[model samples]
Target: MIQVAAAIIEDEQGRILIARRKPGKSQAGMWEFPGGKIEQGELADDCLRRELMEEMEIEIDPYAFFGVNDHHYGATHIRLIAYRARYVSGTITLTDHDEYRWITARELTAFTFAPADVKFVEMLHSSKPRLNE
Candidate 1:
């Protein structure tokens, strides 16, 4: 199993960040929350912070677990830990993705998302963050 971490990064205006997968890559052109595979022995939040910096050149305050998703595709199954994060600072750079957008919840369905991310986006649109934890 491959472990990964994704951020549901929200801006002050309540818009969520989404990125387009670069062409010729696996799941090319699909929109996804920025993140990458977790390296061995690293905690999930550490992975999220590293991936955001590497992929988008941004810093994040990792807070609140959003949800987890498990999905199988072809030969490998992926386990994704999703988190709610607030963007701290960075210049937007596309190291892995082709494009980025700040979109409202209602706009999520407009993009073609990776199967795992699609579920999370749907949940984001349908529910409020539970704060009693």
Candidate 2:
């Protein structure tokens, strides 16, 4: 299974950041918590930090372990590790995503998320994420 890292990044208002998969990328147009694959021998936290920096050019303070999900898309198996993070700084940039949004947990269901990220959205619904508040 391939390991991946994902972050539930919250801005000062407690709105979580979600990104749309860019055109030509896997799962293009689907929304997801911001993050990327964990490189070999890389720590999960480090991978998350690197992904946020590389993909969106934003800095975050990841503070707690969120959860994990195992998913399969055809032949690819993914183990997604997630963390709760607070937005630290930087303008929201999109290199890997076509768009980005900061929304409340209640608003998550409105967007169609990638299969691997569906569980995270469900979890947020079961209980709101009070990241900034």
Best by lDDT: 2
Compose the digit string of candidate 2's lDDT tens values, residues 14-101: 8889999999998998999988889989988899889999988989888999999999999999999999999999998889998999
User: TM-score for every candidate vs. truth?
Assistant: 0.93, 0.95
- The lDDT of model 1 is 0.89
Per-candidate total of colliding backbone pairs: 0, 0
Candidate 1 structure quality by residue, lDDT tens digits, 10-129: 887778899999988899989999899999999888999999998888998879998999999988999999999998999889978999999888778898999989889899878764
- After aligning candidate 1 to the native by TM-score, how far in Å is the CA of 82 from where it should be? 0.2
lDDT (Cα atoms) of all candidates against the true structure: 0.89, 0.91
Top candidate when judged by TM-score against the true structure: 2
Model 2 lDDT vs. the true structure?
A: 0.91
Q: Candidate 2: where is the Cα deviation over 4 Å?
A: 128-133
